[model samples]
Target chain A: MTDRSQLPAIRQQVTELVLAGSPEHAEEAINETAEKFGDLAVVEVLGELEPQVASLHLSSFDGGKMSLATLLIPPKAWAESLAYFAATWDEDWIEDEPEVLAESLFAHIHGMVFGTDDEERRAELLNAALATDWGTTAFAVLFSTAAEEIIEIANDIHNLGAHRSGSTTSDHDVIPMALEIARTNEEGWDRILFEIFPDWRPGENELHAASEEESDDDLGDEEARESEFAMGRSTKELLLRLRKQVPSKAVAPAKKGARPSLGEDIFS
Target chain B: MNITSYTARTPQLVQALEALGQRADEQAAGILFDELCGITALVAKKFTNDRTAEGIHEAFHLTVGCISLAISQADIADTGEAKLSFLLQHGAEYVFQMGFRHIKELSALPYTAFVSDFDNDPFVQQRNLKAIFMEICSADPATTWSGDAVYQNEIVDRKRNQHIIDCGKWLRKHNAAGVVRDSEMDANAAITVAVLFALSGDGRIVARTAQRPLENLIAHIRDTKPDVDASWDKFLKKIPPEFQPLLRERMEQLRGTIVKKLYGKTKPKTLLTELQDHYIGSEQDIDYA
Candidate 1:
């Protein structure tokens, strides 16, 4: 892991560039600079104090809007790019190198947007993603965290003809492809949600609960039936039937504070 | 895990025994069972002292009560044929600790239609019914909380007193006609309107308590002025006896205040102040005495 002390440099560079400048002016600089970097093909910057980590497009080119984001962080937390896939998905990531995969994704998005791989800014982006206050700021922090691979793809597509050895993917096409992959991964999570939250799931049981009047009536009827059968059938059968009927999965809830008394014959 | 194991065993035996008996209605029986299961879950959360046995027991009992109430409401001879308006009103009264006035308002066509057809309209339909009720209450202060805490409590106390007076009046009115048909609506409406009157803090208490004397006065007025409207006379007579005198005195004081302001002894609170002032004396002299 990189030492934590290095984060200040990354934060300072971002504050100086993006924060110090107006959003409109910074946006213009970003668009002009991203094209310049893509044309040059070699990502290099000259400076002792002001290191150019990446070029970002802050305006429209080819009808797509450009926005700029920067990141500064310690090298220790810089090894891997982590993407938060919250709304249920499958574990489709097949690669063994998690950190390398993350880094690659980060480099891809940054390269696509800026046309240069700026490590200082990349590091800062990673730090922001891992920070607790991520939600309060612009949504780009989240996009940046996920942008690693997508950025690389965009950059490769933008500079497609430069490397003659292999063909490059186009920038416009890369985003839709990445979105398709993301959606594919999200299907499993959707299934899990349906399995958990019945109200969100489709069915008569879910619909009945949504109603104001009949829900109480339905609940009443269900309870009476369960109690009537509680003595005549096995508890396992009763529970199984209930679980099958209702969408909510049943786990024997944890008994709190003290053990329950089994002697009372309230049902009898 | 131990408790789960124990519960798993006992409820099974209990279930087995329960299944052997014949139920009043198997469909209703199933619904009741489901409700009990829900209540059991609720009880488990609440009375956790004996989490295992007590939770299950409490839930089972509550479930039984819930099912019984549901069945009773449903089994009554009149079901769907009962007017939706009355059902909605009664349902609100039973479920919500709402005052009668609110019950009337929510059940009114405009509000009920807005809630039920909210989705097609989008602007108002998506809102929850209870939230809409609270919003309506918040907009009208007198319809909700009384102006002050003391007044609210007094209103509640006077309301009960007013109900007693109403029942007495109804009985007297019924006796005069030699009719003895029970009227739930009349009794309910009396208490409900009295609640509003008390809440208004209009010192309608004396008038409300003076129902008997007022009724007698109205009966006399109708007998003498056979051509006069009986219902209008009844309404006027229902106004408390003390309120008439208090209102007259207030009108006189208002006239004096207005005259003083008109003469420039006191500046009017507004430009057209005389128009706003009470001409109650003239109105009352012609009507009441």
Candidate 2:
């Protein structure tokens, strides 16, 4: 939707503002430009102007000062920028490792906006991240570091019945995706899940109840129903096995709506 | 290949020296110093102290050389001079400290050579003269020591004595007007005095001349109403341990006077409590030697 010809002028304006000792103005200009242009185009400009922007930011010597253009820009913009970089990463264009760059950007976003009261922005950012393959490694790290934020976003998405177009991703897709990614690093599965569900446990009755609840809802078609059933069965099996595998001492205290305790002493 | 192996690692040493000289700030200097420390540790482990002395001497020489160069090229209007001076002073101190820590008997040749080089360099001498004049001129009038009476009879440099007189006159004029400016220049002036005193042959005599200034500075600080964020603690920390007793004694005397000034007639217990609240005593030791 953005006019391609305006980018160079915007960049020049930003540079002039920074040079004129109006960093706040420069930040405003950058954010405005990012909003006007799509994320990919703005990110390309940012990548080219990274050194100049970094120098300008570092000259002031206040870490908390949001002078970094990336920080001032929207979360969705950064997510999309990251996605673009991941898609088009080449060794000749970018000397630094793409994964490292993506991780650092994601970490910065997570630090600034993850647990804040910006639920809509957080969901959009998470969705943008999930939309890219470059985010898999970053997500694994994020899953551990920001389990609550990720889980909260997943729950919100589920409640709203939001799914990516042309994909069968449902409200419960996040758990399976997380499990698949987490299995690559098997050592973190117990800790990650414990932090995610906290007091979750698997029992036959609970599994049955979850299946019945799914069935009662509109599943759309026979194929959809069969697929949902298969996914639910696998998820329940994974959770049950994971619940069993987790050391009893590591289990969190039960929350109000958490499942009741089973009689078996897993720790023993 | 045999000849190459036999050759001294002078290029590597030069490269390291250049890298060190290029450090423009305290943080950079600290990083370079840490690297030097690591290199020195490794060298010490691998070779004899005699062999390691070459590298150590080269480092010291390069540090002094860089400082001399910076001094020669300093522009006071810009902050470059202040940054360079900070790097030089702290960098030199770090080098000496590390050398003393690692090498038991650090050869004095490199230090002597640096001093000789610094003294003979006309640019450096001129800079030092200008610095001494500036330090004296900007010094707190109330705390400015009148060295004319003490050094008049002694056979000292005429220019130095004249500068001292000029400083005394300026201090009298400013102190009468109650004009005081707190700046980094003040910290630099103090450092200049300390460095000059250390480099002088008759350091004890210099210390004696500074006694009045030290006392006046302490009294002036005490007379000022204390605040929670007062820089008095930081000033105390800056003074070397050898000079601390003199300042401490002066501070205690000033405290008594201030207490009397505050309360015309107070009990000993009340005075003690008031003093305790006003002045926080510190236990940390400062070593500048």
The C-alpha TM-scores of every prediction are: 0.21, 0.22
Clashing pairs in 2: none
Question: For all candidates listed, what's the TM-score of chain B alone?
Answer: 0.23, 0.17
Question: Per-residue CA lDDT of candidate 2, range B87-184, in tens?
Answer: 34444334323322222211111221111335446676545443332222121212222221112222134333333333322322333224323211
State the DockQ, from 0 to 1, for candidate 1.
Answer: 0.01
Chain A TM-score for each of the predictions: 0.23, 0.31
Which sections of candidate 2 miss by over 4 Å? A1-6, A12-23, A31-268, B1-289
lDDT of 2 at B156: 35
